[model samples]
Target: MNQFESLSRRAIQAPESGIVAVVNHGRLKAGLIPLWAGEGDEKTPDFIARPAAEALLAGETFYTWQRGIPELRQALADYHGRLFGRQLPLDAFCVTGSGMQAIKIAIEAVVNPGDEVIQITPAWPNFAAALGMSGGISVAAPLDYVEGSWSLDPDRLAAAITPKTRAIFFNSPSNPTGWTATPEDLTAVLELARKHGLWIIADEIYTRFFYAGGRAPSFMDIMDEDDRIIFVNTFSKNWSMTGWRVGWIVAPPSIIQVLENSVQYQTSGVPQFMQKGALAALEYGDAYLETQITKASAARDLFCDALTGTNRVVTQKPDGAFYAFFRIDGISDTKAAAIDIVDRVGVGLAPGTAFDKGGETFFRACFLRRLDHIEDAAGRLADYISSL
Candidate 1:
């Protein structure tokens, strides 16, 4: 028997991230146009970047507040007010290392061993793995993509709730499937949460990419300040600061307090200089986002147009977020298709199985590329489908 066999069973059993699975399958080759992971190609704007350099030069390297610098938290509070007209109190925020870390923090704060958390799928793979680390179950309630676009069926989600269900987490303008849950849909889920006394975790990393309502209507929009809901947001998506690794959670004071303590174990504080740049992101990143939205909308159109040349797949234009999730005929195993595309077309895409079994015949492509590149990738994908 292996010496490491005594390690935590859940840790060993948990799957590696699907994004990594694509990479492991062969993505390191030269000249492969990569669109597998969910991030934009844009650089962090100079307005945000310069300040972090300035802060670093100004010797702001030391640790700061455990929750986050007051300036950054308040900046986020103001930003939320500008979007939702709900001026969140400063007490409701906790700036974690990244949106992923914020997810980890929320999973830690709310889930108990052997408890269940219902996730709206297809979800980011890390969500399930994180829950497993805490010995919590990640039960998926898949989205209904019936009319070519993605939507949450409130009744389906409500039915997924069990006596052991402790929480529900959703991402809208979701990754992999650019579905933005409507305000009515959110309210119904919130009602379910209230009925079951379940925590609500909202991952709003892509809220800015939403096609309507300025920003996607959020959990905070319909929630009472004291409700058991936490919002996971990031500078990564909207501000283009993925590598900078900064994100925050919006929750009740009790949850924030718990996070502040738990963070001391995971990461005591986000870098002080990085928080300064985050301050700049909130102050000045709006214009960059507007420009990006315009470009992203065009990119989305170009991607859909190119995909139209292929008769094998069906997808509506994504209403929000940056991905195009579509199903293909004749491909019962999407991972094999993903591998074939990578080998033949020199384009890397994620198999649907990475997201959930419900997505097995589907594949996800990030359109966060130059419109020309997106078109080229789509053409290649179309050729592959035609060959099949």
Candidate 2:
């Protein structure tokens, strides 16, 4: 058999790439103003890069600890403590190649073959793929859109759990939707997990970018030390460190060991210089991130205003994060609509169907571009919708 066909069936049947793949294929014309990706169009702050460069100059290129550099882990622990107002030890955290890898390792550590995993829908599309790759079945619990806001139906979510259900994957300051779960919602989900003895894998990558009150409720606030909760976050979004590939996992000591062993087997360790860069980011990159958040918030406002009163287009002003998820009237094929937007309007966006089955009419526009780019893209989108 050919190598392609000889691969595992599960690997072969994985879902196709959605919006990112479209952008990669040059669907959007060059210089047309693109904002489809989740990251901002900003470089890493000098405070972060200088230290990493220094480390490299000092010949800190070799692999260090399998878990991560001690100083970086300690910085993460301190940062977590400051954010949550609780002391989290350095031993409770493990560094991975990226936030994506952190999620993969967490799932691998907790899920066995055929175990059922519940995921909050309108989620990051890759979450389902990660679970499936770990041999887990994904059960999507979709959020209800009301008054331009997305909310989880706790009862529906609980009902979806079966004895085979081993975990629930949650993302907040969610992708595509830009909805931040309230404390009450988190508490309700935690209660359900506690009752069912299910694990919780909370993806908080966008936690630091919250536009509302500068903070969003987290599973860490409600979870007990012994609860089966794994918190995964990265320096990617907040610090403009997407290319740095430094993310972390916070879990119980047992799971930490599992992740350590997995890191050793899967990729050995994140680069030592990158770990140092992350440490510098955590210590001195706050002001730079704050400026980016302010710009994103302005872009969010401008884009939402531009799209308002357009026929058959409905959007919610995001409480946190920088995405504007909107539904197009009478448009059922989100993938086609997204491609059309790029091809005709020169504005790239992620298709709703990429996030979930229920998102067929929805599409996500990232607001992390420059203010001028946002204005230009908004004009193109307005013109396109008007013509339609």
Candidate 3:
């Protein structure tokens, strides 16, 4: 047998990344006006990046703390407090390489090999891989689409719980589909966790990108100090610092130590310059973030308007995030559909199957580009659907 056979089974068997991999394969040659990733097409704000550049200039690139620099942790704690109206202790917060890493660290802390974890469908595909890497089996609980929106069925999710279920991963202002969990939805999930004694890993990376209202409600809003919830968030979306790789997890003090130790081996710490940049963002990046939010909201509206009368497409007005997830009524081959659109219509999007098995008939469009580009892409997408 080949020595690398196991590697092929483990890595090759992994699910394909819907949009990211497609975009990578297509590159600029695809002639697709790319909107396949979750990040905005804007660069990090000057107020956030300037300090990091200055720090680099000062030659302060050495390692700091394993968990995080105290200043950055404190800033994150303060930001959490401001958003949720409660004081989150610095000791309960641990920083990681990115929001993605935060999820992996949290999963590693709680899940053992063969433990079952439930993930909501139409989720960020990376979540599943993170759980798999930790030797946990992923159980998908799909959301139902109703009246141009997506929602979770609490009873179905509750029923999926088993004694071996260790955790459930949830994303709000969710990636691919801009589905923001409502207050009731969060409460119900938390209640299930309480009943089953399971962990709730909430990814709130896109929390600040809400478009329907000023702010998206968080699980933290309703959670108490005693709740078994680990809230993951990052400065990536709001501060336009996707490349900075600064994110944090808020858990009870019990799991914080596990996360701290896990990250110590995985990555010593987030870079000092990046930590300083994150602190500056928390302190002074609000105005710039607000401006970007306005632009994102406008782009979302433009896309929605463009798809209004398209026959084969059905999309809900997203409440948060920059994505517009829609069903291609008769298209079953989302991967081929995505590739076809890129080659023929010059618009790039993610196939729904990347998010979950139930996503085969769906497609996701990112609206985080310039308004004109968004309008143009939407028109191109409409034309493609019409041709189909």
Candidate 4:
């Protein structure tokens, strides 16, 4: 006789976020070094914030088009063109509240009830959640964690496709895993998507965090205007604007229309001032982004070397992103291990199971904090592993 009993079965069956569960368990404890989310400790730069403030001062805070203000959309198109060296047009770009919303909107627009989406794992849980919230099924095709790094097997992914599969979900410089898909991998996947007549939902949110270069190889670099690709990115990583909640998507004109309609029902558009801030980021964020990428590259080496000192834990320096995804020998219950480490060592990390299948015995720790904090967390984690 509970009032909440009227909720639908999907609502009842949806599991809690394992990352949030661990964070909640550790929140009350004092002196905990948290590295549970895909975020850094840096503040948003003055140049980006000033524009939004100036817009407010100039009294431009009314509602705009749900699709986004035309200037921001055009700015994003031009920025991507400059970044990727491809001529992206304004018709292909749409703005949303966040990258998560972009993924959700793209999923809902492309899929119907009972449709299956082929996703590469160990994926961010939201990828599967987006599919589920749209009444679609997710088929996980895991990447091979070979010799210390994660690699994609395109044939394995192609094999996962079935008559019910409507799309393929791809994340490069993947969250938690930090695997950047090769250009060859992209070509292979594109061929499969074409063969199966499937859509491609690409999460390139970590594009600016590449370790070796200005940006990671992207599907956008090679995608044609008519290709079945929906690319999603946010201002969070490059501009450190996670709290701003501004993300953009690139899709075909037909789906762009759907995204416009979806944006109306989603959040009725992001704030006009916030869109101004995003435009500023597109204009002036390059130098700051390069600095952050250099910092992350250094931190990756420091953290990975710390874990490599002991043979008990297996780890690889990530090619991109700010995560150290590693495995502990003989431990199958990663969630339990992660919670125990939090309780004992005063360090926090996300368990492998929280991501998707093939994550057992693995965990993800972000290294985007201050160097001292990263060193302290690294020492604590290494000490815990050595003691085990």
Prediction RMSDs, each to the true structure: 1.4, 1.4, 1.6, 1.3
The TM-score measured for candidate 4 stands at 0.97
lDDT comparison, 1 vs 4, better candidate = 4
Off by over 4 Å in 1: none
What ranges in model 4 sit over 4 Å off? none
Candidate 2, 1-388: lDDT as tens digits: 9999999988987877676676775553776676778889889888999999999999998878999988998998888887888798888999999998998898898899899999888888888888888788999898888767788899989989999999999888898788888999999999999999999999878887687766788988888888999988888899888888888999997678888998999889998988889999888776887788899889998999888767557777888888999877777887787777777878888877788756657888889978998999988888988888
Task: Give the lDDT of residue 132 in candidate 2.
Answer: 84
Q: How well is each residue in 1-388 modelled by candidate 1, as lDDT tens digits? A: 5867988797789887766777777657777878887877888888999999999999998878989999999998999889878877898899999998999999988999999999888877888888998899989999987846777888889889998999998888887788888889889988999988999888888888877637787887778865898888888877778899999998887667889987788889999999999999899888888888877888888887777657677888888898888887778778887888888998888888888647777788888778888878888888888888
**Candidate 1: pairs in clash:** none
Best by lDDT: 4
C-alpha lDDT (0 to 100) for residue 207 of candidate 2:
80
The better candidate by TM-score, 1 or 3, is 1
Off by over 4 Å in 2: none
> How close is every model to the real structure, measured as TM-score?
0.96, 0.97, 0.96, 0.97
| CA displacement after TM-score superposition, residue 214 of candidate 3 (Å) | 2.7
